[model samples]
Target: MSFLTLLRRVAMTLLFILLPAASGWACTPVFVRGQASTLRLNVGQLTVPADARPGTPLYHKSFAWNRLSDGGEQWIRCADDPHGLSPLLLDSLLSGGVTRPTVYQTNLAGIGVRVSLRAIGGYGCFPDRPTPSPFSQRVDNPAALPRCGVETGLFPPDD
Candidate 1:
């Protein structure tokens, strides 16, 4: 082939290789940190409606509790089927001073899988009775509490 023809082909090939990469830059994933906590469960233990195959990884921004100013709490559960966790199980934990626990789980193939539950933030109001400590004492600092953050495999069992 002629040198000019070869040069033209090389330039076209290079453009094709870089076109997709340049376009993808505009569609970057946005991750919101410290936004409202939401439950993320893996596909295991709990039965999926067979229809829920797989979906794209959800991008989270931030997490907020019910009562940020007041005494409120949030939780995250990570497990195979966090959604399947019984209310009683959660109630038992809450009774002990746990609230709004965030749950997360890894995507399991079919049978049992691993899961984790953690408290993200909490707040409490002060007592109205005659006490040495003020109501501010009743409120627990969320930042002081432990943070639960987990990285799980992507949906569809692949990235």
Candidate 2:
């Protein structure tokens, strides 16, 4: 092949490689429990008090995620459900690009994050109840993303 053709092919290859990292939903809060291959959780900052006890979840920064994605995710950082979630707010967060305040709160410090999304089934974690509990539930947001509970890929975006 000619030099021009070779250069074009190399350029295309490089684009594919670097595109993902660049296109990744940057600046958005993602807490991957691998609970579900594609169960994308948009959560808030976790505040575990210095005097808090073990085996007890102080309180998670109320997270939200929907199957819809048009742009970036809007997360409420450091606000631990200070005010109850209103129906309107819930609907907005569960609909499309989040429009809430911008704050950074990633809490993946000691938690394990599953890198693959092709798991046969989703990781069973109870969002309503902490682990080591007798209760466990699957991702069931029928009203929002019907397919959010299904696992399909092993990478970021398009999972």
Best by lDDT: 1
Q: After superposing candidate 2, which stretches have Cα over 4 Å from the reference?
A: 1-36, 59-107, 111-159
Candidate 1, residues 44-139, lDDT tens digits: the string is: 344345555443223222223232313334333223333221112223222213332222234345322112223442312212222211012322
Residue-wise lDDT of candidate 2 within 74-119, one digit each (tens)?
3332133322221212223332244322221224532222211111
What is the overall TM-score of model 1 with all chains considered together?
0.17
Worst 10 residues of 2 by lDDT: 150-159
Give me the runs in candidate 1 sitting further than 4 Å from their true place.
Answer: 17-21, 27-31, 35-159
All models: lDDT? Answer: 0.33, 0.32
Q: C-alpha displacement of 46 in model 2, angstroms?
A: 1.7
